[model samples]
Every structure is written in C-alpha cells, then in structure tokens.
Target: MVSSKIIDRELFERILEKKNSLDKARPLSAEIVQKLRQEMEIEWTYNSNAIEGNSLSYEETRRVVERGLTIGGKSLREHFEAINHVNAIRFIEKLVEKKQKITEQTILEIHSLIVKGIDGVREKGQYRSGTVFIGGAVFTPPPPIELKARMLDLIDFVNKNPDKLHVIELAAISHHKLVWIHPFVDGNGRTARILMNLLLMKKGFPPTVILNVDRQKYYRRLKEADRGKSKPFVDFVARNVERNLDLYLKAIKTGKDEQYISLQEATRHCDYSQEYLSLQARNGKLEAHKLGRNWFTTKKAIQAYLKKHATKNQKLKFIQ
Candidate 1:
C-alpha cells in the first residue's frame, strides 16, 4: 500500500489550501450562484453517466433518472444509476465507519468495490491501469515490477496524512501519482476521476465530474500537474468543484426564496421539450422548485446537458 513518509508536512499544506473553500472562491451574488448550483447538479449526473457508456439520450437519460432503469444491460447500468452517488456512500462510510481516518487499505477497498462491475475491461479491482503518460504523452506502462514500490509509497502517504491537508489537493495528487504509476491495465482515467471525487466528498464537498466534452481541458490540467506544478491542477479541480457549487447554489438560492421556473421555461432556455423537462422534474430527478402546479429549473443544468449529451443516436426520451 502507501508508505509512512509520503504524507509529510508539505503535502499537508496543499490539502489545507484546497479544502478552504472560501480562500479561492471568486464570489458571486447569492442569486446567481444558487441558480448555477441547481443546474449543474442535474446536468452533471446526466453527462457523467453518458460517458461511462450509459447510452441514454438527453430525454431518455432524464426519464431514467426520473423513473426508468436499464437493469437488463451489464452491471454498467446499475453502476451508472449512481455513477455520481458512490462518492456520497464513501463519505458517509468514512465518517461513520472509519471515523474520518484514511489509510492505504481504505483507498484501495473503496476503489476495488466501487468499480467492481467494470473488471475485465477496466481492471475493476485493479490499480495503475498499466497506462502511462510522460507529461501528456501516452505510452505503454513500464513493467509493473519497476513501479510497484513507488505506487505503494504513494498509497502510504495518503493514509498517513488523512486530516492535516485538504482532501481535494491530496485527491489531485493521488490522481496524478496513480496515472504516473500506471498500476492497473485500464480504467485509470475514470478511476482517477472517482478518486478525486472521493477526496472532495471526504471533506463534505460535492463530488465534481470532469465531463467528456471538457476532456481536452481536463487532460491539459493533468498534463500541467505532471509538470510538478500546483496551480493548474488545483485550479482545474477548483473550477470543476466551483462549477458543481454554482449549480447547487443556484438551486439552493431559488429553493430558499421559493423562486420558480417552469418546464417550458427551462427547456426553452435549454432545447429539451416541455414534456422532457416535466418528466425530469415530476419524477424528482432534477432540481426544481414548484409553484402551485408548475416547476422550473435553473439554466446551468440545461446547458451542461446540452453540452455533453446531444448526439445522433438519442436514447428513448419518453417519460417513465
């Protein structure tokens, strides 16, 4: 697993910086921010599930989030059902079961089980992914024997420094380190992203999804971090987190003020049909506040969706 010396004083500082939400916040009016939050939450789930190969179109995906389940497919569907939720499960488990302590074993166990369904193709229970990138250059991994010890050391560092530094920063570090190790044979990218989310969730922050659409920007950020730079990776993670918060805050703001937007309104702002929007809200799958009989969602959710899932082979769009 991980070594004792990795979580030294310096690593702790980076964690602190990442977790102090207020320190780097750009600050926005409560009204604007809340709307963004509501929108991002709804949209991120849809897009993240899609890239995981969920195969649901915009409306169909919304309907599934609302009421349908693709249980017939490989376990991928079930896993996709809560592709965004495993982080929440990990958070509660850590706090309630492990009492806020992290160890190399804890990290491995979390990863092994969470991605279990993707085994053969992705080494569901594996690590490193046997994939390597020499500063943005993808290359075949070196023999596993050569890097196993370093990978173990990284794990040890993570467990040792559990609470001193911010989890987010550690997450960013682990993500880069794991990729560098190329420990597993597949699923490194997805696994790394989930590990990052686990870090945020450990600290009571919402898990962030780096959408496939943003793959270029996301890889660029990772490449920057591999250069042994801090801000670019931290900034990249911060942006993803803030994007999530913007959606949550938007929904929360309107949710607090009882501000309301309707399905037609949201879809118009988006491009989905009123029926599609209603199915989403009616089933309580999306973030929307109801006014009498009508409900409306913030624009962030809609934009993120349009950005990620609109394609030629749309999934079924009917409301369940």
Candidate 2:
C-alpha cells in the first residue's frame, strides 16, 4: 500500500484553496474543460436499471442535458429519470439550458430518487431498509431519534461554514458524512454523487461525474477517504476537475475565432439547429472572453466580417 505520507491531506486542501479562487483558470485549457463537462454529463445521466455499458452517442446525448437544465420543475425522481435518457443531444441540451438551485430539501429530494428505482428500495425515503455492513463490521445508523437532527446539523454546516471552503471539499465531506450518518434508508451512493455535483456546479466547477468506467476506482477512493484517508479522494476529485476543465476548453477551442458560433448560427452549420451562431454574440461565453465585438467562428466569422464591412445598401448573400 502506498504510505499515507505520500498523499498529504494538506496537499489536497491547498489545491482546493487554489481552485476556489475565481479567474484561476487560463484560456489555454478550453478543449479539456469542455470534454470534462461532456464526460460528467455522460456519467450522471445513467439509469440504475440499465447495463453499465449502455450510452448515447454524442449527438443524441445533448438532449438529455437540455432536460437536466429544466429539471427543477418536477418531482425529484421524475427529473432524474428524464435526464438519464440514453441520448446525447437531449442531455447536452438540458445541461446548456438550465441551472438548478441547491438546498437541503434539494438534497433530500434527490436522495429519494436515487433509491426509488433500486432493488429492495421498499424503504425508499426512510432511513435504512436493508442490512448494511462496513469493513466487515455490522452497520448501524444513528439512532432514529438523532437522524433528523444529524441531517439538519449537516445542512446547517454546509450552509453556514466560514472561510468559504471549496465546494468540492464540502461535497466530498457531504458524501463521507452522509454515509456515516446514513440519513436515509437507501439511495446513498447515487444521491451522494448527485449532491457532489450539485455542490460542484454551485461552485462554478461544472459537474464532476464518475463514469461507470471509473466506478471501481471511484469506490476505492471513497473507501480510502472513509478510512481517514483524505488526499486520495481529493486526488480523485482533482483529476476529475482537471478532466472537466479539459472538456470546457475543447468546446471553446475547436472553432477558429471565426467559428465562434452564437446560438443564432445554428441553422447554417447543422441540419437541425434550434440555436444559431451570430456575429453579435450575446451569451456569457463571449462576455467571459472580454472580446471587442460579439462574433461567430470560422465560416460564420467570415460572414460577420463581411457584413460588418458591407455597404449599407448591399444585401449580403452567403452559404447556408
């Protein structure tokens, strides 16, 4: 076993301290950052019943994301099922469209959904319905009398913490402590992951989804964290952050300055574009870049450049 000394918890804390700083990132990492976002969406958009290998292709997955963006309107479980569709187009659409609020009740609602479809989920939202064992030890939840208070204390801690801790650390601890408290009867694992991302997204880090491909490693890291080993889990999370950063960067970099398609530019490049890429970029993406003018990319860039220089009376004809 690698010695605990090799992975100092403080190292992780230092990283967390740094990441929480705004503008800590550079434009050079656009590609990687976008991929991370895509991967995270893929990971969270899973069905409890489906074989782990099942997934939507890139195009089909975006729609599911669109659904996730609007997930706030419905019951927790219904929203989860809607987002977990095996379609990339749907997933990305949801992700790009909406942002959900985080709160104690939101956590509970999600907890309810994660356990709802699982086998032996009869206990559903209640505290432990099935036997649980940890480290060859019989497991017992906090006394029923204490369960609600413990949960309340946790939510209070999350909301009232001083010094502005990194949301990821807050999230990791939420996973650890929630399991320790084992507040609900079921859905602990799934709910924990969802809450982790809720915290992540709340912190502007985007979602950090643990892919089925990384499930074994993820579990092992969690085990280490539970055993009073914090840095390994931090490393696991940092790696994910790094991965997500890669994804975001990718989405931003692929197009040349000219290809910077706005939502309005959609119709010209793709077969079905509800959104378009326009020269006058109005989204946060361009504002974040501190550019002189809103513009699309590559081919679209040329059109905008031409339109800007066009004679007032001349109508511009361009390729679709």
Candidate that scores best on TM-score: 1
Model 2 C-alpha lDDT per residue in residues 1-320, reported as the tens digit of each score = 11223334665445444443323544435544454444545545653212233344332334445434433333444444435332322322343357644456666666555454545557655665344554422345576678778887877766765434555666777766676676666556656666666566665665665666676676677677767776677667666765655444434554454323433453453332323234233443222221112223445444553466445443244545
Residues 116-149 of candidate 1 have per-residue lDDT tens digits of: 5553545545455343544444444566566657
Per lDDT, the best of the predicted structures is 1
lDDT of 2: 0.51
C-alpha RMSD of each candidate structure in angstroms: 11.7, 10.9
Model 1 residue 228 CA deviation in Å: 2.6
Model 2 error, position 133 (Å): 2.5
- Residue 150 shift from truth in candidate 1, angstroms: 3.0
Candidate 2 deviant stretches above 4 angstroms: 1-40, 47-103, 116-119, 129-131, 134-143, 162-164, 254-320
Lowest lDDT sum, 10 consecutive residues, model 1, at 311-320
User: Scored by CA lDDT, what does every candidate get?
Assistant: 0.54, 0.51
